[model samples]
Target: MGRGTAAGTVCFAVANQKGGVAKTTSSISLGVALSDLGYRVLLVDLDPQACMTFSLGLDPDQLERSVHDVLVGDAEAAEVVSATEDGPDLLPATIDLASAEALLLTRTGREYALRNALEDLLEQQAAAGTPYDFVILDCPPSLGVLTINGLTAAAEVIVPLQCETLSHRGVGQLLETIADVRKMTNRGLQVRGILPTMFDARTTHSRDVLDDVAMRYELPVLEPPIARSIRFAEAPAAGRSILRTARRTRGAQAYADHAKSLAGEREAAS
Candidate 1:
């Protein structure tokens, strides 16, 4: 319901209904980049797949508690939050999250579950003088209850669009979902813009797709598109972001620049 935390934590949901669009990658990268800028960040693994959790070097299967516990009312978010080696705190996910939808469907005001949990956590953290500067929600590949919770909780949504024809196909539908979330749950929710990922300037198709989506959806396309790099694939294996694994790579630099711009925007707004 609130646009940000009392301590000014800007929440972002990196969402795209389509899979393999670098949603998790962007989430982890941005979180780490923000942390590198000396801000405290929290990365919430809302996806049942737990890709972000594992990518951050945490094993979802071995975890005693997770975000699933928080969402199901069995545990508070602070109780389940863990520190990642990569500089950000994480509310990890497990396969049990796959059942959260069915369980939440029977609960009243289910869509606000995440928003309420995070608000409570923020209050607790702020009281302790350890407030986060950013919260990044890595949404799943489907517009399910989990994704709805993410949208309802975040003040802004960053849609990661792979530079391909089919990648932009679901942008319209996702936009409609955001609009509905605004009307029903989080009226303060806004689309940060479409983030072009895995862009290949060497190909005209990549350039064309980026141009077409911006014009068609009338959404701001963030500058310096993330280029395709094998380093992105290798980082997960190393349990780090591209920023750490390949610090000097173009893809890593793009995310750093993006994070700086985001931090600057928040500063400007304040």
Candidate 2:
């Protein structure tokens, strides 16, 4: 596979400035869903908390290498990638990543660190005849250097939001960051859509907030809101996505549908 043939790899940064918005959950679940569709996917844990790494059943404390190592050039991106039982590959994170922002601040072209690393890995994988189809980044809970690297690397952004006032507060700030990123770094970056996570259809307030957000931002709300489910919390303990831990549940089904919708959109765009 040549470099030109590797353009099919789509990178997504699942980002929101606010914590507990299901960024890691959506990243893992969506990667699993895409893998279920036979696409080779890689989930990159950009959060210093290593939530995505721990969520996939890996103990970050015990890892010899992580995304932090890759970012600091101590390791290649491929070296940090581990296979998950759920199907997609993961570039795990560790608490050591907390210092990555400060380290990157002194470096030139720091925002392209993730993009350059991922592109090199993708080229190698393409040469190996097993190219990844997608790369999903689980960004940190802040708009710091790590998240900026994520936004700069990704071609599109997926913001997972809880349907509530406090959760919605950061959307404007996130959009502003996206606007800045588009102007300053990744000119092709776009907000794919807003993903409503931990949504409860039974509550009228949830519905109202969702509608208001869509109207206010004039952004597409990705279909099939993920229903509030305890299974999301339970999956991490089991080292799998909700798709596997509770395959028949509403949340898993919604994510499966979302992945299929994303594939359809990609096809249409192509």
Candidate 3:
């Protein structure tokens, strides 16, 4: 692990309504890349699957605290945060998160639990002087409380879509949800950009999806899409990111490029 960069808060929700679009993969890898660039990143795992939690080698079952506790008001945000060797911090989720939906139905401010929790956390961090530069929320596949909480908490949303036709259908639905969140909860929110995942130039279908999405959403598209590569799949299994697993692979380089673009520190790579 290396030192981190000091910057202002720039929170983003890595989201998409469709599953298997590499949303979590983008969140985890981008967090690692941002950390490598010296920014202190906080990854909020809102997914019930806990893949992000386990990918970092944290056994959620054994941990005394999780994001569920923080969101449910049973624990403080500080208590649930855990530092990592990858230069970012993580708010791990647990199986109990699967029940958070039904449990939150009775709560008055169910949609704002995560937002309130983060505001409370920032208040404490601000007094300390070394505040976080970004908070990346890895939202669950569904647009439920978990996803809404992330949308409400984040300043921007990054939509990750696979280069496939079916993956294109949910963009409008997610954006509509984002619009609703902005109308009621967070007006400062905006769409960061759209990222195409598992993109393979060899496939004509990939090109069609990209063209269709560009003409439709009209959001800035991240070029040099993450190519389908074995390295990206292998990196997480070892609790490592592409920068470590296949640092030289095109897929790894693509993630780094995406991070640089997000931070406005570097232009998109060719």
CA lDDT of every candidate: 0.93, 0.88, 0.83
Minimum summed lDDT over a 10-residue window in model 2 is located at 1-10
Reference-based lDDT, residue 170, model 3: 78
TM-score, cand. 2: 0.96
Residues 144-204, candidate 1: write the lDDT tens digits: 8999999999989999999987677989999999999999998889898999999998999
Which is the leading candidate under TM-score?
1
- The TM-scores of all predictions, comma-separated, are 0.98, 0.96, 0.92
Better of 1 and 2 by lDDT: 1
lDDT value for model 3: 0.83
Off by over 4 Å in 2: 1-5
Report backbone clashes per prediction. 0, 0, 3
User: Higher-lDDT candidate among 1 and 3?
Assistant: 1
Error (Å) of candidate 2 at residue 78 is 1.4
For candidate 1, what is the lDDT?
0.93
lDDT of 3 at 132: 77
lDDT of 2: 0.88
Q: Which tens-of-lDDT digit does each residue in 225-265 have in candidate 2?
A: 99999888898888888898899999999999999987776
184-217 per-residue lDDT for model 3 (tens digits)? 8888788878888999889899989888887898
